[model samples]
Target: MADYSEASPPPKNRQIVLLLSFFVGLTIALFLSVDLMVGVLIGWIPPGVERQLGALIVPAFEQQAAPSSAQDTLNQLLDRLKPHLSAEQQQRDYKVLYVPDETVNALAIPGDRIILYRGLIEQAESENELMMVLGHELGHFAHRDHLRQLGRGLLMQITISSLFGDISGIQSIALSAAQTIGNSRFSQNQEYKADEMGVTLLQKIYGQVAGATDFFARLSEKKDLPIDFLTTHPNPGKRVQRLEKLIQQNGWTVGDRSPVAESLKMP
Candidate 1:
């Protein structure tokens, strides 16, 4: 009688399967560790090194930015918010580069620069709202969210390239770093923390948190609008809820909102 016995799998096939599983597990572990490592390593990175990384990325935005009254208005707002920052953050010369593009977005890049697009300005109905937005970006700087967005891998590459004085490697890494930042998204917790910081600064500067959630509340109402800010940021509705809660929890009062300056208003 023919014996019906299950045959063992081929050794080669089993080896390949195990090897693939090993690599997959290793990849998952690395990814999970990167964020934790980045959090620890970021605090150690000096502002000077950050500027070097920014040197590679800021030029692209700088070339796109034009000097205008709008830009001047933005920097003035940033200057007003500067004193509210910690002494360490105040040491860096923070400025705004207002881009004429109507992309409806703002960015806190490596170079202590806030890239504010005209589209975002057009969305603002009040000076307080704009100041809150500016304050929000400063919060990113204070928390080093910009660097955190770059990931530990690219950060390591940049640091190593800089240390070794590898000009060519550094140049290549710069492009990667810029692309990573452009496409990256901040975590919801990070956004909430930044919002809290913005609210605190708004209260300190204007003595009330008026317009703290106005910009976000407005954006949340216009769901049909194709705003780029919504893409990289958390849902506007959620942010509005969180900010409102923060204000109430702290017993902060909401006062009148200052009107946006004519020069800064989008046509």
Candidate 2:
């Protein structure tokens, strides 16, 4: 306890601490800069490159999907929404791979494919509501949200691997990216933008925004189910409120909903 007030770290220890602090600070700065570049980088990615990356992941879903009338019907519905997409989006080949599973979820993967689970289709009470869900997925594609979900770390890895022509490394990263995409949750702002796009598309298809929020409203009531859709998506109640506000702001009219196609009805 002698002269404790004058105690100081040795010169060597101080240098070590300074080096560690510098590295930590540099790492954080690099992370933030990479994140900031993600939006801009994604815009520069061509559809061809996106499809190549998607090819690595699409096979897994393709194996799960069973080609049937249900899959056909889902694709047909997706086609209907195509006309309303932007000219650039319309040029890309989009399809739906319908999986006959009880998981209530839909996904827009990199390869311009929408994965629609049977459970989600069963939950839809009307054609328009189902279309709204489809439109929402399409919104993801329009905004390049699927790639954005890959996170900054994986994105930077992919970019670097591709730049170095490391095909094997890219494939490995793609596999991990697939798993991440399956469980990823979009940002609340991303969800809202998708909802806005969905409602706009619904209006174009039906001349009214009927059933736009019906699916979400119903799901919002069932809070106990261990549903993947609920797990990965933003709160349904919040989404419904936002959609209603958007519809009101835009003077969108609500009308009767169309019946779900027989092909999509649960047996």
Candidate 3:
């Protein structure tokens, strides 16, 4: 009883300690929130690191079967389109890779890489439709949307890895989840921007925006939208409407359709 005063702290000191603890907790919470937002909304990974990560990540997800003949055809198409790209676009070293899959999907990744599945090529009703798809993917690359997507994915993995000390067994799971989230999360505004750029590129290369919306219009006619990582594009009907509006505004006329390349036959 005689030593109680010496053992007990003053009320002011207790209040100060409480205030400090509150601030420290608040700071930690704020940091975590910022980290989440950066991973989800502000993909800002540096280019070199993004390429390195892409080199490691993309191949793992691609089908191993080779598409030598289809690839040659794709390259020929790419070469034909190259003359129309601006110096800025051409200088970026854009590449289109063919994946031997029948998923009817295309993916634009970091390092200016675009992967087109054989199914998508076969699904196109005309050469103009296929070019529209290529142009749309190129638009994504030009805007660095591919980098942004890859960055966001890596950020999520890094965060999870840091918390768990490693992501050995979980890397595939994390990647799969990231791909799902990233594919579906591209905003409507971003979709519009890519569409606008695609139409512009089509007009530049082919002299008209004909069949720019052909793919979307076909999808819109489906009984149900294809549910897959490849279907990240905006609502099919809405995308067609937007493209039609843009074409009308620019006084662009639809051009004659060209048959799909014979060599582009699906495997």
Steric clashes per prediction: 0, 0, 0
Pairs of colliding residues, candidate 3 = none
Question: For candidate 2, lDDT tens digit of each residue in 113-170?
Answer: 8999998888889999989988998999999999999987777777776667777877
| Candidate 1 C-alpha error for residue 246, in Å | 0.5
Per-residue accuracy of model 1 over 159-190 as CA lDDT, tens digit each: 67656766677677778887787668898998
- The TM-scores of all predictions, comma-separated, are 0.85, 0.86, 0.70
Q: Report the number of the highest-lDDT candidate.
A: 2
State, as a TM-score between 0 and 1, how close model 3 is to the true structure.
0.70
Q: Cα RMSDs of all predictions?
A: 4.8, 4.8, 9.0
Q: What's model 2's overall lDDT? A: 0.88
lDDT for 19 (candidate 2): 94
Off by over 4 Å in 1: 1-32, 165-168
Look at candidate 2 and tell me the lDDT of residue 13: 81
Model 3: runs farther than 4 Å from truth? Answer: 1-44, 61-65, 151-153, 156-185, 229-231
Candidate 1 global CA lDDT score? 0.85
